[model samples]
Target: MLTSKTRLLSLDAFRGFTIAAMFLVNNPGDWGSLYPQLEHAAWSGWTFTDCIFPFFLFIVGVSLHLSLHRKVLADHSETQLLLQLLKRALWIFLIGLALNLIPNFDFQSVRIPGVLQRIALCTALAAPLVVYSSWRGQLLVIMALLAIYSFIMLAVQVPDVEGNLVAAALEPGRDAGAYIDRSVFGNHLWKQSRTWDPEGLLSTLPAVCSVLFGVLTGHWLSAKRDIAEKTVWLFIAGLACLAIGQILASWLMPVNKSLWTPSFAVFMTGWALIVFACFYWLLDASPAIHLKNRMIYLMHPFIMYGMNALFLFTLSGLIAKMLGFIHLPQTDGSQPSLHALLYAPIKALPVSAVNASLLFALLFNLTMLIIAWGMWKKRWFVKV
Candidate 1:
């Protein structure tokens, strides 16, 4: 088994992979021509794009456990740790809000619910549970949160657009969560659909469960046991979660990403566990030293990307915004966004529209990778 001092290269690599995937999905040249897997599911069910946020949240949980456990072992005061977490979460949330402000900077219609904002909220909320709760307690909290959220989502009556009380439903912007968001956030909701946000407040409860599941996995990894045993059990547990989540999808709420349904939370945790277990086995737990070295070398790029994931995530968003914000004069005297201008040549390439779009995303990822490599070489880690 690895010592506490031994850095988990597998975790870093997994995080890096997730960040890279996020860039790929977020920066497609043509949003209109994306492959199905690159886009989120329309409403219910899920696609590969659905897995990214849950994976990041799971990584956050694991990282939180490992880091906080270290501080506790060193006899750090609880108040100090709590303050640190809050400070970090606050900065992240503000950064997310700033990103939402963008070129327009319109606070009136700015989106309050966002990916990083959700991450920040989840981190802040899960902090106490991670700091004070036992593994069993954390598990119970996850169960309770899921059950309570499921109950509220299914049973709560909400007012519709007409201000009439309506029974609980899961139809697009008509759901209870959406109604709550509309009522609370008002003009501050997601602009595309002002009535609801995928990252709305009520749905955040289950998202915390996603992070706590990772925390539990972190506990398992930190326990004194054979690394191989840990890997095996993690995979087994993941399979169990997967089965249970699938059953819940049919019996309770369908696997919906927008809702952050209980089934989606559990099912994605299963995926996170299974995927991370494979990485752990191959990169950390494997008995074959030569093979492990080769694997590590191959995954070093991801490690670099993961090291400064938050910075890269924020930077990527800003750059993407700028790309669309700046306009270029066109031949007909009309203006096209820099994004459109840059994409025109690529779209004109003798390739399929989807392939061209995919190429642009890959190129954008390459730019990010180069920056990551530079920062890695300089040891310039940007901590939140």
Candidate 2:
């Protein structure tokens, strides 16, 4: 039921919205003290920052449903569907790798796992399952996958846990995930962790579950029901999912994204479903939504995603680095970084740190938006 124009446009807007948030939270003026909303929940809770990634994954599932359904309705050959899936997955995965090389290209130091790569793998795994099986089957698969991941992550002890099992036990409070990932990837792990990759192969199983939950929501949307009815069901479903996720998290697994716990998938998908219902009601069904149509301004988010997104994210980091490299001379001819210099006037006063960080993020995001606008003016959609 998605329109060629409207469907892609809505999806692009969703993608851009999430990516814009990514740039905002990531490039905050100071990480040490950020708005609690901007910081990812330390552990075992949700925050605004955590919503963005799951939202992206949910968007992926929404679009995938429309895409695969259209293929079926068109009577497309199975070969064609498979080919499209493979090509799209490869493209996303490769782009993630290519972006890892930006600001500096060092193969030895490059991260093996990243946002797009995780998306690519999750989509590849979820799509085939969604398209080939019934929605009930997909639901069962989601349950099984979550159960398996929970058991593997929380129950299975690392080989090296015992003193002579393989090596001395790690210090208390350490997770088994890091040890497992290190034993598997060793030196090929993420540079950030120096041992485990957050987007590692093992964690992606639950990532697939995230997509499966999205697919389940997609099925709910596709059901033969009026918009109001659909909205009501979606809200109910979201609440049910939240309850189930919390129950499972307490009993079987902890909701940790670094390990991609299945409970995290359920909880995030529940939130995404709730949001989709809100947007659908406001934008499509509400007669009083006078300015809702104006959201089309963000219709070309894919252009931002494919062309300027990585450029912009990397650029923000470079901007911070450049600020650090500044050597402004003080009255005593003492050198201070630009940020240090700027902080004197702002932080010296009693002001909310969040206000400053938000302003800086807004300015940078607007700059990225202008670049995206320029590309739009030229009809230049850079597809990956």
Candidate 3:
């Protein structure tokens, strides 16, 4: 029912929702003070905030399937299309690297693995398969990726601090993934957590499977099935995934976002599918025509944000960094960063620090909304 040029309103709305959540969670007025739901889980276990990154990656997989399928249908040569995908992936990775070097511009100690870099890597690896492989083949590849990652995590032995190569446990800074990252990138990893990188090379294997799961969902949506039938199947698949992921988590691995564990990938994919299916039903499948129209209108701001997701995401990161970089002198001779200065108004509110932080996040998202509205008005979309 959809075409290359025909915009899927539900997809846009879902993407917009994820982008808004990401901005709100990432740019709290105070990192030291945040609502528990807005912060990531300490090590393991899932939270509302933990869902944003995986949601974005899932959207990426869906977009890739639709876009690449469109290209194939249009008679684009496989060689030409692959080249374009590769170039886009390269640019995304370079942009992520450039963003890391901002403010300090410190090349020697810049973190190599990051959100955008991981997205780029996953896109580069998954795009070829999504474009070329059958649905069953893609499913097999997804299973293979997760299986490989699990084997490495459970079976690989790493030398401990004392230089004894023992089977690595899932401990902070000492996990198999962390050891591999330290070996590969050395000190050029997440400086805050020097011993490990959450988006490290080994962990990216499961992350790739996460995207592949999205590709599978996209292929299903694109199939010539009734809307109700599609929704039912998506629901069924989500439940099965959730059950499988839980079993894996309990027996073999833990569900960890940082590690991109196999169980985590499967669990989050289930969530992604259910959430997207809900959106599709509410926005696209509703029989009430007037109500559907009203719902679409109500979601205009989110649709605007969704349309220019990458641009807004990158711009927001830059703005947040610059705020940290610039500081103003205070009365006591101490300097407060721009972030603190902006937080002054919210800090004065008669609320708990966490509640005040939540207000600040809402205000920040309002600013993004205005910018997105302007872009929407002008039909300005910045594509990568």
TM-scores for every candidate against the unseen true structure: 0.98, 0.82, 0.97
Tens-place lDDT per residue, model 1, 1-384, is 234476899999999999999999999999899999999999889999999999999999999898887887778988888888989999999999999999899988999989999999999999998888899999999989999998888888888777767766888788889888987999898888788899999999999999999999989999989888999999999999999999999999999999999999999999999999988998999999999999999999899998999999999999999999999887899999999988889999999999999999999999999999999999999997
Clashing pairs in 2: none
lDDT of 1: 0.93
Tell me, by TM-score, which candidate is best: 1
Better of 1 and 2 by lDDT: 1
lDDT of 2 by residue, 1-384 (tens): 544333443345556667788878876656676888898776666788888888878877776777777777778886788678878888888877776765467777677677888888887888678668888998898889877766666566665433233322222223455666666666656775566666777778878877777777777666667868877887898898788879868876666667667778888788877877766665554455555565433344533553444445445556665666677887998998887776556555566787776666666677678877787678676554
Global lDDT of each model? 0.93, 0.69, 0.87
lDDT by residue for model 3 over 154-185, one digit each (tens)?
A: 89889754566767478777778888888889
Off by over 4 Å in 1: 1-4, 330-332
Q: How accurate locally is residue 114 in candidate 3, as Cα lDDT from 0 to 100? A: 96
- Name the better of 2 and 3 by lDDT: 3
TM-score of 3: 0.97
